[model samples]
Target: GAGVSQSPSNKVTEKGKDVELRCDPISGHTALYWYRQSLGQGLEFLIYFQGNSAPDKSGLPSDRFSAERTGGSVSTLTIQRTQQEDSAVYLCASSLVAAYTDTQYFGPGTRLTVL
Candidate 1:
Protein backbone atom coordinates (compact mmCIF):
# COMPACT_ATOMS: atom_id res chain seq x y z
CA GLY A 1 0.00 0.00 0.00
CA ALA A 2 1.05 3.58 -0.48
CA GLY A 3 -0.17 4.75 2.90
CA VAL A 4 -0.13 3.59 6.49
CA SER A 5 -2.04 0.37 7.17
CA GLN A 6 -3.39 -0.99 10.42
CA SER A 7 -4.70 -4.37 11.34
CA PRO A 8 -8.00 -5.27 12.96
CA SER A 9 -9.82 -2.13 11.97
CA ASN A 10 -12.11 -2.84 14.91
CA LYS A 11 -11.69 -4.82 18.07
CA VAL A 12 -13.94 -5.85 20.95
CA THR A 13 -12.43 -7.12 24.17
CA GLU A 14 -13.54 -7.78 27.69
CA LYS A 15 -12.21 -5.94 30.66
CA GLY A 16 -9.04 -7.44 32.12
CA LYS A 17 -8.20 -9.09 28.82
CA ASP A 18 -5.19 -8.28 26.66
CA VAL A 19 -5.03 -7.01 23.11
CA GLU A 20 -2.38 -6.28 20.55
CA LEU A 21 -2.68 -3.80 17.71
CA ARG A 22 -0.46 -3.64 14.69
CA CYS A 23 0.61 -0.85 12.38
CA ASP A 24 2.55 -0.82 9.15
CA PRO A 25 3.85 2.55 8.12
CA ILE A 26 4.76 3.67 4.65
CA SER A 27 7.96 2.20 3.34
CA GLY A 28 11.09 4.31 3.80
CA HIS A 29 9.39 6.45 6.37
CA THR A 30 11.51 6.43 9.49
CA ALA A 31 9.12 8.30 11.68
CA LEU A 32 6.03 6.62 13.09
CA TYR A 33 3.53 7.64 15.71
CA TRP A 34 0.65 6.21 17.71
CA TYR A 35 -2.26 8.24 18.90
CA ARG A 36 -5.41 7.56 20.87
CA GLN A 37 -8.74 9.31 20.42
CA SER A 38 -11.30 9.11 23.12
CA LEU A 39 -14.75 10.56 23.36
CA GLY A 40 -14.76 14.35 23.67
CA GLN A 41 -10.98 14.51 23.47
CA GLY A 42 -8.67 15.11 20.56
CA LEU A 43 -5.95 12.85 19.41
CA GLU A 44 -3.59 11.98 22.23
CA PHE A 45 -0.05 11.12 21.31
CA LEU A 46 0.80 7.72 22.65
CA ILE A 47 4.26 7.11 21.28
CA TYR A 48 6.73 8.01 18.58
CA PHE A 49 9.44 6.00 16.86
CA GLN A 50 12.31 7.49 14.92
CA GLY A 51 14.09 4.72 13.11
CA ASN A 52 13.14 1.96 15.49
CA SER A 53 14.08 4.07 18.51
CA ALA A 54 11.34 5.62 20.58
CA PRO A 55 12.79 8.90 21.77
CA ASP A 56 9.53 9.82 23.46
CA LYS A 57 7.29 7.32 25.12
CA SER A 58 6.11 9.73 27.72
CA GLY A 59 2.74 9.92 26.07
CA LEU A 60 1.93 6.37 26.97
CA PRO A 61 -0.86 6.39 29.51
CA SER A 62 0.67 3.81 31.80
CA ASP A 63 3.06 0.91 32.13
CA ARG A 64 0.33 -1.44 30.97
CA PHE A 65 0.59 0.07 27.51
CA SER A 66 3.69 -0.53 25.42
CA ALA A 67 4.82 -0.42 21.82
CA GLU A 68 7.80 -1.53 19.77
CA ARG A 69 9.05 -0.99 16.27
CA THR A 70 11.03 -3.68 14.52
CA GLY A 71 13.49 -3.28 11.63
CA GLY A 72 12.40 0.33 11.58
CA SER A 73 9.14 -0.65 10.00
CA VAL A 74 6.28 -2.56 11.55
CA SER A 75 5.10 -1.60 15.02
CA THR A 76 2.82 -3.10 17.58
CA LEU A 77 0.89 -1.70 20.56
CA THR A 78 0.06 -4.01 23.39
CA ILE A 79 -2.39 -3.24 26.15
CA GLN A 80 -2.54 -5.47 29.18
CA ARG A 81 -5.28 -5.62 31.80
CA THR A 82 -7.64 -3.83 29.51
CA GLN A 83 -9.97 -1.30 31.05
CA GLN A 84 -13.08 0.36 29.71
CA GLU A 85 -11.20 3.62 29.58
CA ASP A 86 -8.79 2.07 27.16
CA SER A 87 -11.49 1.70 24.57
CA ALA A 88 -10.93 4.22 21.84
CA VAL A 89 -9.74 4.74 18.32
CA TYR A 90 -6.09 3.82 17.90
CA LEU A 91 -4.45 5.70 15.08
CA CYS A 92 -1.12 5.17 13.36
CA ALA A 93 0.81 7.79 11.44
CA SER A 94 4.05 7.98 9.51
CA SER A 95 6.34 10.47 7.84
CA LEU A 96 9.79 10.89 6.44
CA VAL A 97 11.00 12.23 9.74
CA ALA A 98 9.44 13.41 12.96
CA ALA A 99 11.59 16.27 14.14
CA TYR A 100 9.86 19.49 13.10
CA THR A 101 8.85 18.82 9.52
CA ASP A 102 7.04 16.21 7.47
CA THR A 103 3.28 15.77 7.49
CA GLN A 104 2.03 12.68 9.25
CA TYR A 105 -0.10 10.35 7.18
CA PHE A 106 -2.64 8.53 9.32
CA GLY A 107 -4.30 5.19 8.87
CA PRO A 108 -8.01 4.44 9.00
CA GLY A 109 -7.59 3.60 12.70
CA THR A 110 -8.72 0.68 14.80
CA ARG A 111 -11.71 1.18 17.03
CA LEU A 112 -11.22 -0.81 20.20
CA THR A 113 -14.15 -1.60 22.42
CA VAL A 114 -13.46 -2.83 25.90
CA LEU A 115 -16.52 -4.16 27.60
Candidate 2:
Protein backbone atom coordinates (compact mmCIF):
# COMPACT_ATOMS: atom_id res chain seq x y z
CA GLY A 1 0.00 0.00 0.00
CA ALA A 2 1.11 3.57 -0.56
CA GLY A 3 0.40 4.37 3.05
CA VAL A 4 -1.28 2.85 6.08
CA SER A 5 -4.89 2.06 5.23
CA GLN A 6 -7.70 1.19 7.62
CA SER A 7 -11.14 0.00 6.65
CA PRO A 8 -14.57 1.00 7.91
CA SER A 9 -13.69 4.52 8.91
CA ASN A 10 -16.74 4.35 11.13
CA LYS A 11 -18.45 1.46 12.86
CA VAL A 12 -21.60 1.44 14.97
CA THR A 13 -22.58 -1.69 16.85
CA GLU A 14 -24.74 -2.61 19.79
CA LYS A 15 -23.17 -3.52 23.06
CA GLY A 16 -22.16 -7.18 23.34
CA LYS A 17 -21.50 -7.52 19.62
CA ASP A 18 -18.13 -8.12 18.02
CA VAL A 19 -16.30 -6.06 15.44
CA GLU A 20 -13.27 -6.51 13.26
CA LEU A 21 -11.09 -3.71 11.97
CA ARG A 22 -8.52 -4.05 9.22
CA CYS A 23 -5.29 -2.26 8.53
CA ASP A 24 -2.97 -2.37 5.51
CA PRO A 25 0.47 -1.01 6.12
CA ILE A 26 3.03 0.35 3.72
CA SER A 27 4.94 -2.21 1.74
CA GLY A 28 8.23 -3.53 3.09
CA HIS A 29 7.65 -2.02 6.53
CA THR A 30 8.90 -4.26 9.30
CA ALA A 31 7.08 -2.80 12.27
CA LEU A 32 3.37 -2.33 12.89
CA TYR A 33 1.44 -0.99 15.83
CA TRP A 34 -2.15 -0.60 16.98
CA TYR A 35 -3.50 2.02 19.32
CA ARG A 36 -6.78 3.25 20.65
CA GLN A 37 -8.07 6.73 21.43
CA SER A 38 -11.18 7.20 23.44
CA LEU A 39 -13.11 10.44 23.29
CA GLY A 40 -11.23 13.13 25.21
CA GLN A 41 -8.39 10.68 25.82
CA GLY A 42 -4.87 10.35 24.52
CA LEU A 43 -3.50 7.60 22.35
CA GLU A 44 -3.17 4.26 24.09
CA PHE A 45 -0.72 1.74 22.69
CA LEU A 46 -2.43 -1.57 22.17
CA ILE A 47 0.05 -3.85 20.46
CA TYR A 48 3.34 -3.97 18.62
CA PHE A 49 4.75 -6.50 16.16
CA GLN A 50 8.19 -6.72 14.62
CA GLY A 51 9.65 -9.56 12.62
CA ASN A 52 9.19 -12.94 14.30
CA SER A 53 9.55 -11.80 17.88
CA ALA A 54 6.66 -12.18 20.28
CA PRO A 55 4.02 -9.52 19.79
CA ASP A 56 3.61 -6.96 22.53
CA LYS A 57 -0.02 -7.28 23.43
CA SER A 58 0.44 -5.74 26.83
CA GLY A 59 -1.64 -2.68 26.08
CA LEU A 60 -4.83 -4.44 25.13
CA PRO A 61 -7.49 -3.28 27.55
CA SER A 62 -8.74 -6.81 28.09
CA ASP A 63 -8.97 -10.25 26.55
CA ARG A 64 -11.94 -8.97 24.60
CA PHE A 65 -9.54 -7.10 22.36
CA SER A 66 -7.10 -9.04 20.19
CA ALA A 67 -5.07 -8.51 17.06
CA GLU A 68 -2.86 -10.36 14.60
CA ARG A 69 -0.34 -9.30 12.01
CA THR A 70 0.11 -11.58 9.03
CA GLY A 71 3.08 -11.75 6.65
CA GLY A 72 4.32 -8.51 8.20
CA SER A 73 1.87 -6.50 6.18
CA VAL A 74 -1.80 -6.63 6.97
CA SER A 75 -3.25 -6.59 10.47
CA THR A 76 -6.60 -7.02 12.09
CA LEU A 77 -8.10 -5.91 15.42
CA THR A 78 -11.03 -7.71 16.90
CA ILE A 79 -13.14 -6.62 19.84
CA GLN A 80 -15.51 -9.18 21.22
CA ARG A 81 -18.57 -8.58 23.37
CA THR A 82 -18.12 -4.89 22.94
CA GLN A 83 -19.31 -2.48 25.58
CA GLN A 84 -20.49 1.10 25.28
CA GLU A 85 -17.26 2.13 26.93
CA ASP A 86 -15.37 0.60 24.01
CA SER A 87 -16.41 3.37 21.68
CA ALA A 88 -13.35 5.09 20.33
CA VAL A 89 -10.98 5.45 17.43
CA TYR A 90 -8.75 2.52 16.60
CA LEU A 91 -5.58 3.67 14.89
CA CYS A 92 -2.89 1.72 13.07
CA ALA A 93 0.65 2.76 12.41
CA SER A 94 3.68 1.28 10.67
CA SER A 95 7.34 2.06 10.36
CA LEU A 96 9.98 1.03 7.91
CA VAL A 97 11.82 -0.41 10.84
CA ALA A 98 11.57 -0.36 14.61
CA ALA A 99 14.76 1.58 15.10
CA TYR A 100 14.86 4.57 17.39
CA THR A 101 14.77 6.97 14.46
CA ASP A 102 11.99 5.24 12.55
CA THR A 103 8.91 7.38 11.98
CA GLN A 104 5.55 5.75 12.24
CA TYR A 105 2.92 6.60 9.64
CA PHE A 106 -0.65 6.62 10.86
CA GLY A 107 -3.87 5.57 9.20
CA PRO A 108 -7.14 7.50 9.16
CA GLY A 109 -8.44 5.05 11.78
CA THR A 110 -11.70 3.28 12.38
CA ARG A 111 -14.19 5.09 14.57
CA LEU A 112 -15.88 2.36 16.56
CA THR A 113 -19.05 3.05 18.48
CA VAL A 114 -20.69 0.52 20.74
CA LEU A 115 -24.20 1.74 21.30
Candidate 3:
Protein backbone atom coordinates (compact mmCIF):
# COMPACT_ATOMS: atom_id res chain seq x y z
CA GLY A 1 0.00 0.00 0.00
CA ALA A 2 1.43 3.31 -1.06
CA GLY A 3 1.14 6.47 0.99
CA VAL A 4 0.86 10.02 -0.29
CA SER A 5 3.64 11.08 -2.64
CA GLN A 6 4.87 14.31 -4.22
CA SER A 7 7.08 15.04 -7.22
CA PRO A 8 10.15 17.18 -7.74
CA SER A 9 11.46 16.76 -4.21
CA ASN A 10 13.15 20.14 -4.69
CA LYS A 11 12.50 23.18 -6.85
CA VAL A 12 14.53 26.34 -7.44
CA THR A 13 13.06 29.31 -9.20
CA GLU A 14 13.41 33.03 -9.64
CA LYS A 15 11.37 35.49 -7.63
CA GLY A 16 8.77 35.97 -10.35
CA LYS A 17 8.58 32.48 -11.77
CA ASP A 18 5.65 30.15 -11.38
CA VAL A 19 5.81 26.57 -10.11
CA GLU A 20 3.51 23.60 -9.95
CA LEU A 21 3.76 20.93 -7.28
CA ARG A 22 2.09 17.57 -7.72
CA CYS A 23 0.71 15.06 -5.25
CA ASP A 24 -0.66 11.53 -5.42
CA PRO A 25 -2.78 10.31 -2.55
CA ILE A 26 -3.05 6.78 -1.29
CA SER A 27 -5.56 4.52 -2.96
CA GLY A 28 -9.15 4.74 -1.70
CA HIS A 29 -8.43 7.86 0.35
CA THR A 30 -11.22 10.37 -0.05
CA ALA A 31 -9.65 13.44 1.52
CA LEU A 32 -6.60 15.35 0.33
CA TYR A 33 -4.92 18.43 1.77
CA TRP A 34 -2.15 20.85 0.90
CA TYR A 35 0.09 22.63 3.34
CA ARG A 36 3.09 24.90 3.44
CA GLN A 37 5.89 24.96 5.97
CA SER A 38 8.59 27.53 6.27
CA LEU A 39 11.88 26.90 7.99
CA GLY A 40 11.25 26.27 11.69
CA GLN A 41 7.52 26.98 11.23
CA GLY A 42 4.59 24.67 11.61
CA LEU A 43 2.48 23.36 8.74
CA GLU A 44 -0.13 25.80 7.46
CA PHE A 45 -3.13 24.36 5.70
CA LEU A 46 -3.62 25.76 2.22
CA ILE A 47 -6.41 23.77 0.66
CA TYR A 48 -8.44 20.62 1.09
CA PHE A 49 -10.51 18.32 -1.10
CA GLN A 50 -13.06 15.76 -0.06
CA GLY A 51 -14.76 13.43 -2.53
CA ASN A 52 -16.26 15.52 -5.36
CA SER A 53 -17.04 18.62 -3.36
CA ALA A 54 -15.50 22.01 -3.96
CA PRO A 55 -12.05 22.49 -2.51
CA ASP A 56 -11.54 24.62 0.58
CA LYS A 57 -9.19 27.40 -0.40
CA SER A 58 -9.63 29.66 2.60
CA GLY A 59 -6.15 28.90 3.88
CA LEU A 60 -4.46 30.07 0.72
CA PRO A 61 -2.23 33.00 1.53
CA SER A 62 -3.14 35.13 -1.46
CA ASP A 63 -4.49 35.17 -5.00
CA ARG A 64 -1.20 33.83 -6.26
CA PHE A 65 -1.83 30.43 -4.72
CA SER A 66 -4.28 27.86 -6.04
CA ALA A 67 -4.88 24.10 -6.18
CA GLU A 68 -7.03 21.46 -7.82
CA ARG A 69 -7.87 17.82 -7.20
CA THR A 70 -8.79 15.65 -10.15
CA GLY A 71 -10.95 12.54 -9.89
CA GLY A 72 -10.65 12.73 -6.12
CA SER A 73 -7.14 11.40 -6.42
CA VAL A 74 -4.26 13.44 -7.75
CA SER A 75 -3.80 17.07 -6.68
CA THR A 76 -1.68 19.94 -7.82
CA LEU A 77 -0.68 23.18 -6.16
CA THR A 78 0.33 26.12 -8.29
CA ILE A 79 1.99 29.32 -7.20
CA GLN A 80 1.85 32.20 -9.65
CA ARG A 81 4.38 34.98 -9.79
CA THR A 82 6.19 33.37 -6.95
CA GLN A 83 7.87 35.51 -4.35
CA GLN A 84 10.79 34.94 -2.07
CA GLU A 85 8.37 34.62 0.78
CA ASP A 86 6.83 31.64 -0.94
CA SER A 87 9.98 29.63 -0.44
CA ALA A 88 9.10 26.72 1.80
CA VAL A 89 8.28 23.04 1.91
CA TYR A 90 4.95 22.21 0.32
CA LEU A 91 3.40 19.13 1.91
CA CYS A 92 0.50 16.88 0.90
CA ALA A 93 -1.61 14.64 3.04
CA SER A 94 -4.50 12.28 2.55
CA SER A 95 -6.98 10.65 4.86
CA LEU A 96 -9.57 7.93 4.68
CA VAL A 97 -12.32 10.34 5.65
CA ALA A 98 -12.97 14.07 5.76
CA ALA A 99 -13.48 14.29 9.47
CA TYR A 100 -11.21 16.35 11.67
CA THR A 101 -10.39 13.30 13.74
CA ASP A 102 -9.40 11.11 10.82
CA THR A 103 -5.80 10.02 10.57
CA GLN A 104 -3.80 11.68 7.81
CA TYR A 105 -0.74 10.36 6.02
CA PHE A 106 1.82 12.93 4.87
CA GLY A 107 4.17 13.07 1.90
CA PRO A 108 7.82 13.97 2.04
CA GLY A 109 7.05 17.38 0.49
CA THR A 110 8.56 19.54 -2.23
CA ARG A 111 11.09 22.09 -1.15
CA LEU A 112 10.70 25.31 -3.11
CA THR A 113 13.49 27.85 -3.14
CA VAL A 114 12.89 31.30 -4.58
CA LEU A 115 15.95 33.24 -5.55
Q: Pick by lDDT: which candidate is best?
A: 1
Candidate 3's C-alpha runs over 4 A off are none
TM-score of model 2 relative to the true fold?
0.94
TM-score, one value per model: 0.97, 0.94, 0.96
Regions more than 4 Å wrong, model 1: none
lDDT of 2 at 1: 36
lDDT of each: 0.96, 0.90, 0.92
Displacement of residue 97 (Cα, Å) in model 3 is 1.3
Clashing pairs in 3: none
lDDT by residue (2-102, candidate 3, tens digit) is 87899989999999998999999999999998899999999999888897564577999999998888898899899999999999999999999889699
Residue 30 alpha-carbon offset, candidate 1, angstroms: 0.1
**Error at 58, model 3, angstroms:** 0.8
* Model 1 / residue 58 / CA error / Å: 0.5
Query: What are the per-residue Cα lDDT tens digits for candidate 1 across 40-104?
Result: 78999999999989999999999999999999999999999999999999999999998686999
At residue 106, candidate 2 shows an lDDT of 96
Estimate the Cα RMSD of every predicted model relative to the unseen true structure.
Answer: 0.8, 1.3, 1.0
Per-residue alpha-carbon lDDT of model 2 for 7-112, expressed as tens digits?
9999999999999999998888889899999999999999888953435778999999988877778888999999998999999999988879999999999999
